[model samples]
Target: MLNTSRRLWNQFFRKARKVNNEPLNKVSLIVLIVVDIFILINVVMGLDDISRWYISPSQAEPCYSQWQNYRTKTTTDKDFEIIKNSFFGIDNPLSQEQIYQQVEERHLGKVSQTCFQYAKYQEQINIPPNQQIIQNIEQKQIQVSQFEQSNSNIRAQYDSTLLEKIAGQSREKSINVVGAEKAKQELDQNNQRISTLKQEITNLKNQLVTKPESMNFLGFLQEDSNFNQVEVNYQQASFWYPSIQLGFQSLFLVPLILVALSIHNFAQRREYGLIALISWHLLVIFFLPLILKIFEFLQVGVLFRFTFDILSTLLGGLLFLISYVYILLIPIVGFGIIQLCQKVILNTKAQAVRRIQDSRCIQCAKKIRTHDTYCPHCGYYQYIECPNCHNLTYKYLSHCHQCGAFQESSHNHA
Candidate 1:
């Protein structure tokens, strides 16, 4: 059974992996983490062996023995005949196929009952179940089969296909009877509805021909005040309705924009192009994070959350496309894209340079790349003395790296 289950899982997983054509990523990682959590709960429920197919022979012995006893008793013994007909209700010896199925079900039940009994009232058994119990069960099962072989004159047999055909015909006749009754009822109901609707249709046709002559009927050409009220009610409901209720539910562009802008910003920052670096971060990192949080918060309810997720997934895709285009055009926002890159640099040295070495424009963090040394981000720069180590650095640096100290060094140095 374990082997069978493994084959099933392998077949399923192989198909999934083939369709993707690539290994899993962070999203898949996140999903698997969530799956693992549910699997842990299932493991606790003690259904693990159903998946693994590892039922012990000791557990199978009693079920196998009962199956053999019933198999032989059905052919020659009247008492066995009653038990077999009552349980399976088929006048046939138990087939190999039926035995296998019964064994599987019985073992599963035994495992579940055993686990439940152990948990419901604690008892400890240290040693493993021995082969003697399993062998005894197998011997009893063999005896019934041997007895049937020895008494072929009394033991009558019918092929499974013929037996199934007879059983199926009976079932089919019963189903046809039920279906006929249902169809007759439906036909009567539909006939009644058709008569009623025909009367209404005739009335409507007469009104269409005669109503235009009435002056009061001119109101039909104008707005119906009742319909206006319905329209207003619809508008009110639209705000709270799930995206399906709102026609353009597929086009949730906000989250898409954030994720796209973030990816773009990340790439631009890596390339050191300044525009996309800033734009990407401002839109995605700073904005997208805040947006997801707000969306999750607002959609705390299940129906609302599912609707929100669908809309958000759609919008997020479009936003990503836009972000990619923008990141190509403007490089600064690339700061936001760093999180996507497999390799992340702490860049303490570069960060130190950004903080202390280069002058940053007050309005932004753009580095002053040229000697004129005006702050590039905001174009705000001023020359300041390094009180410590006497090595001039950006005032924003706060601590002097030269002296390994917080304040500028008071002592003069070249």
Candidate 2:
């Protein structure tokens, strides 16, 4: 066992010496590192492209604005019905166009005045400080107040005059009079004006609430039933999403694993020859960029989202819960599994023997090892030292006294 271990150790140190001493071997190591870095960069860029594909520019996104418009139009239609029932009443139902016209006429003068005031304020900002900007603003404020007060006074006077005329008509001996009809007509016109103003105010407020700019993706998905069709489309797209993403991932990760294994092999074989090290590193460098280029052809994230949408539909809310839990636990579970394998299955004598024969763990085929009852690194048992020859021999093999000698079995004469 001692002899076998010494031989293996000697071999490793000799390889290390060649790798450290030879200029060509050192150059290959440097090339390998550079290539790994380049491959890593490409992987990052590919991931970014995938993200962009999934996220999509807000302006260019299909169905988003149309959904918003749909909401706005529906809201407007509902408001039309409410206004018709509340103000126009069953006796005199109004068309949408007629309601719009009445509302516009009711608010036209006031809206125009407000717009003029805003325009004047804009002009004020452009004026020089030497000019009476402040004084002009103050003057406009006073004028607005006076104008409102005067209109109120005029309305009050008209109301008082109307009441006095109605009272005078009532005082007549006979209740039936010519002026009563005129008074009734005047009151009816006044009530109609007030109703029009109220309806106009209600419609404007509703419009503000139902505007297209108010909705967002999450809110739309969560609350709005109108987006169900769009959601279904997305879900349908998701079916192919996983395959595209996995393909891209494999493109980069498979080569990365291969390159890493090659580097490890180069480290071991460096003692044998610089030619092996250089050739292995050359292969890694040659393939890394090619693997990365596959990303250019893949829209991984977009595909993923497309698939996810349908998956969500099929799985419902369970999909979201599973995804969340999986994302949170995958690393932890993976690390625990690795640790357990190392401590249990990989740390056996059979595994150690395989490692000695193959220069890698039999179970994983990823890590290198040396001869020992149990590997010092991986804790896998390999060979036991012969008591006499002090050489290594397989633990499971049967020999007379097990001297660890290389010999063929003979048949006993009967």
Pick the TM-score winner.
2
Q: Estimate each model's TM-score.
A: 0.21, 0.32
lDDT of 1 by residue, 280-383 (tens): 32343233433443344334434444545565687775654544543453343343544333124433224435543443332233444545446543344533
lDDT of 2 by residue, 1-414 (tens): 354346445544443334333444576657756765775577667655543343222211234344445456645454323222222222445533344344445431111222233223223222233123333433554555554554454554555555656667344553333344454565565556555554654554444334342223223333565456444545544444445454555655566656755665555433335544444444444455544434333234443355556668778877766466446554565577557754574343444355446665332233444443454433545454555576765553333235635423211100
Ten residues in sequence with the least summed lDDT for candidate 2: 405-414
The RMSD (Cα, Å) of candidate 2 is 20.5
Candidate maximizing lDDT: 2
lDDT for 298 in candidate 2 is 29
Which pairs clash in model 2?
1-391, 1-392, 235-309, 235-310, 237-306, 238-306, 238-307, 239-307, 241-303, 349-381
